[model samples]
Target: MTEQRKDILDMLAAGKITAEEAEQLIAALERDQAPAAAGLDARPKGKVKYLRVVVDATDNGEPSRVNVRVPLQLLRAGVRLAALVPPQALVKANASLSDSGVPIDLTQLKPEQLEALVEHLDDVTVEVDSPDATVRVFCE
Candidate 1:
């Protein structure tokens, strides 16, 4: 449990707050911290550590546009295959991603899910600059 969670529990145990209050506190904490790193594979696959994934997409002659907090593993895989995508193979590639753990939910992905995602992605790199908690996918 996080220090904040422990503190919340302790407060409830001491009757400083009611159970409902404790639950609400915990939920508040989660929500406040959720959006910044919310995504499957946000952390290193299989670990509870906090992380974030950002996706940068570019179209013909256009500058890149980014989607933040994308699933680290899924985006890792997608970028790899997307670079060499044969137009008709996108669906198959995404299905393969489903096998890895990209979780259609997009909130978080288990390690197994990340592994599943990796298996389907043809070529991609997952880089972690820990201080930043961001994963950058280079589609080539």
Candidate 2:
């Protein structure tokens, strides 16, 4: 473990805080070290959990790079935002994106998520595989 993690553990062992507090601290530390949006907290009632999606393409046949286990909520939100670009405009845009190899339906995202999606769309490559609902957004 790193020095910071060790310190947190030491604090825990010394009874400076409860296990729950220690857990939250550890999670926050991990989140800080991870890539943006790498950690997701628990969703409220009627929300999703444990959704996974993997989006990858080969660059030289040795498995270029991959992003796995993305949140369904994020994907839903992005598609939702794409819904606001005027129905005819959205239709044209979706048609333009038809060769991206993933099936995307833009009208099902929540309002808040849709807002975030519009900003994220330019930076992501979305993928959804069969038998699961998660989405993979491979960043270029």
Candidate 3:
């Protein structure tokens, strides 16, 4: 444990802060220290808690909107669970996805690689606008 973490724990033990506050402090410290501690690139790998999609549109002179928020933890769990799937099932799933124009290989979805991709996605925001609607996809 680092000195900062130890100090946070000590504060928690002394009732100087709540458990929730201690957890937040620890998480913040880890995020700040991760890049330097890993000895890899200096890029920060922050955990994404949610994947958000928002759409605003005008339909026949009436305004409409759509909002979707998906917990990223579910995605992580799904990737980990995929390892238990049979190879034949994975092949069939891949075929189905390809048929639906997804063009993704399910067998290649390693959790570590997915985590790295999600980390990069933290800085990405995609937006599209058409005559009728505007769509946005981002991580938070």
Candidate 4:
């Protein structure tokens, strides 16, 4: 065990820190050390290429299912295309979207922002489960 881990354990044994506090400290240490400790495993595994959504549901004795996989490259292409659209058209579209309760401004989107969003997507997985349905959205 590392000296930090030993210190944490000693603190716990001495009642100087609560168990939960010790666990949290250990977890933080592990997260901080993971990349260095991983060595060869720290290399990128693979690029995320797709955004996926899956749904399964039953409603009033009827069942439904849906599965979707969207290419990440398509999103990049769309962002590029958005730049080609006329500003007036983008304004109109933005107004329409607002009217439809989508409060988004197309004119504000930037390539760098989109790239950041794509990077963050790799760490995001959304899942919902209820008595009647299950839904998941993630990147792969």
Candidate 5:
């Protein structure tokens, strides 16, 4: 029905191209356009707003799945809130986190840094596959 498809059929009708050749051309055209047609939600890479974690596993021989979508705006807001906390409280929180093996400095959390981190996350995707479980982490 498309112009290119019509052209291919016309070529076949005129005997300029064989039926097989016309079929191949139509198939190639569909393949080339499939991604663009299917990607209805395509967005700019820099505009990634959610951090997604998806897990599928067999638990006790029963299949289970987990899908989590966390908005990047929530993290940005948390970072902004951290700025209002007293320095003494931040130090205590940092120490507690370190004691718990987190090793993160709460005082170092800045909104700009979080934004930059989220932007970089757009380019990162992590996948873990095993017989029992599969995990995927990406930005969307």
Candidate 6:
């Protein structure tokens, strides 16, 4: 348990606060600490330590599986580093991505926006399945 949580419980045990108040205080504390705790992978419940991508498929009647775990911090750092790229390079990259049918524009990817997106990704799970293969992306 975190010190904040422990303190809240202690107060409750001492009748310094009612059970309902303690519950509210704990919930508030958890909410406030969620982002930092998630980044550090310190919380047990709903904490994502890695970005995982899994693929399972059959090729010519043979089965194959690929599993990958990437640290979320790496992605955050990459996004922040993108700000250092030359504008011309970003423009070219954006054009290439558009040509490849990925409609995203790299020039518009700000670090702050990426940080927000990554934070939101903690609760996101994506899966795609077809007759011969399945792909899954999630945080864990």
lDDT of 3 by residue, 1-140 (tens): 89999999999999999999999999999999987767666456677789899999999999999999988777677767766789899899999999999999988877688777765766789999999999999999
- Answer with 2 or 4, whichever has the higher TM-score: 4
lDDT of 2 by residue, 56-98 (tens): 5554555444445545556666566555677677566666667
Candidate 1 residue pairs in backbone clash: 40-108, 40-109, 80-123, 100-113, 100-116, 100-117, 101-113
> Which candidate do you rate higher for lDDT, 1 or 2?
2
Candidate 4 on 11-49: residue-level lDDT in tens? 999999999999999999999899787876777766889
TM-score of each: 0.31, 0.28, 0.55, 0.62, 0.55, 0.64
> Order of all candidates by TM-score, from best down to worst?
6, 4, 3, 5, 1, 2
* Top TM-score hit: 6
C-alpha local distance difference test of each model: 0.60, 0.61, 0.87, 0.89, 0.87, 0.89
By the lDDT metric, which is better: model 1 or model 4? 4
lDDT, candidate 5, 66-126, per-residue tens: 9999998886777677668898998999999999999998778876886687668778899
Clashing pairs in 3: none
- Candidate 5 — what's its lDDT? 0.87
lDDT of 5 at 11: 92
For each candidate, how many residue pairs have backbone atoms clashing (under 3 Å)? 7, 0, 0, 0, 0, 0
- True-structure Cα RMSD, model 1: 15.6
lDDT of 3: 0.87
Please report how far candidate 5 places residue 17 from its true position, in Å. Answer: 50
User: Mind sharing the TM-score for model 4?
Assistant: 0.62
Could you tell me how far off, in angstroms, the CA of residue 67 lies in candidate 1 after the best superposition?
34
Comparing candidate 5 with candidate 6, which one achieves the higher TM-score?
Answer: 6
Candidate 1, superposed: residue stretches over 4 Å from native: 39-140
At residue 113, candidate 4 shows an lDDT of: 86
